[model samples]
Target: MLSERQQLILRMIVEDYVHSAEPVGSRTISKRSEVSFSPATIRNEMADLEEMGYLEQPHTSAGRIPSQKGYRFYVDHLLHPFRLTPQELFQLKKIYVDKIDAMERVVQQTAQILSSLTNYTALVLGPQVHENKLKHLQLIPLSDRTAVAIIVTDTGHVENKKVTVPEGISPDEISRFVAILNDKMRDVPLQHVKSKLYSEIMSELNRYMNQFEGVMSLLDQIVEVEQEDRVYLGGTTNILNQPEFRDVEKLRPLLDMLEKNRTVFQLLSQQDTPGIQVRIGLENDLEQLKDCSVITATYHIDGKVAGTVGVLGPTRMEYRRVIGVMQQLTELLSDLLTRLHR
Candidate 1:
């Protein structure tokens, strides 16, 4: 365990270095009103800190910077909860006030808001059908033998299916099928929609309709959920703004990882117990992510982990502020998505 004075100094160094992007020296530490230690005494402690592997002295400067170890220690022990300023809170609230309707739009705007506020790359994984409950289903006629079936979920995910309206089946019959299905299956888990449709609703529809089998087949096809693998990204180029990524060689793999959707999905979906996960330098398994930190929060539907939102930046990240932003977004996203179908 570090002494109280040492812990205080480490915290100061991490906080100052994160924003300034420069090495911190004992003289710099001494200038703070809270630090009573002289520069010489602080320098002695700094040398001890470097030996302990908590600090690194760059060859170009007499000042020292926090090593990965120092950052981890600061995050795990010395970091305090950062409260969002009133302006920050307003910016977050504005996302919901915009009243975006589709899940795609909501996730898109969320990615934009996050990257704009933090100036870090943002990734948002939108929930799939299994993570949502059925809100409504409708059919729109396109031609004499064709129609479009649209499925809307509680989380605002939309899936469209093209239906072949049987030669004899009237539009009135199609309308009835939609009404009955909505009445019976409203708010049912999407995975169970097929089972319930086959077992319960099928028998009732058989009496009036002659093409019952074909209509049921069409309904099954319409509800057969497979088209919802979506990821919204923002500020993909923002990493260039960070000092650590200024070199093209250092930025290559990370930029490559961002460009591929499947790889990003895998990265964002690292199932850590739920809520927020903070993976510091080298803690994340990806070779390209060794120097980066990823902070993710799970947004849920009916208390199940449905999707994730994350911010990626260098290890010298603003953990306190970013974590606070994640916490706020988690709650806001949950509320906005949850209230949609209700």
Candidate 2:
């Protein structure tokens, strides 16, 4: 339990360091109107704070910086949420108003806006196909040997891929196969398509089509390909703007981790459970992110968890503002999805 003075001093140092990205001295804090102690008294309290693990003294500096434990304590207790400025709200509103028709575009644009607003890297995971019910399926022949396979989900997501047509399969036969697939798989979640395809849909396909095996294989490819998670990133280079990341060699691993879609997908999806989650410093468990912090907010469609939006920055991040912006955007994203689908 910290004394009121210690708490006040810690909060002031955190706020100052977040703003300036530099160690804070007791004299600098003593000058604040809210601080009533002399620099000598404040220095003693700071030493105590450092001994208690809330502060760290860099080499040769008589100043202190908030340790990860200090940041965690400050965020959980001292942080206060602030409302967005009218200009910030207006910028957010403009994107939704202009791009409401396409949820994917809205998500992509939202990522860009988040990075621009925070000057940090932003990643938005698109709604999972497994959560969406199958809506429609179509096969359009582009040539004798090739066709385009299209799958539409209940959430208005359209996925298409070019596939080679099996020999001896006519355009009429392809249409019939698609008709059968739509009839059996309509309204099924994408994740269950593989099991349902082999267990139930296969026998039905075998009954009418002589080339059922070929059609089944093609449909399997379509369903399997669509299951890959999509991650939209914005301002990946913005990490370069942070003082801690000035060393390109040190920043390489983190940037490399971001480039792996599967890795970023796992990082974001693991925290998609609920609310705004904060992973500070080594709490992320990834060595590449040991000096960083991640704030994630899950966005839903009609109360069902759809995806996540996240901001990644140095551990010295302005937590209150970054958290507030993420929370507001998450709410708006949910509302936009609900209204768009309606």
State the RMSD for candidate 1.
4.0
Q: Name model 1 segments beyond 4 Å from true.
A: 102-104, 135-150, 161-187, 201-228, 302-304
Q: Per-model C-alpha lDDT, please?
A: 0.84, 0.86
Error of 2 at 87 (Å): 3.5
For residues 238-319, write the lDDT of model 1, one tens digit per residue: 9999999999999999999998888888888776458778888899999999999998989876576768999999999999
CA-RMSD of model 2 = 2.6
Query: How many residue pairs collide in each prediction?
Result: 0, 0
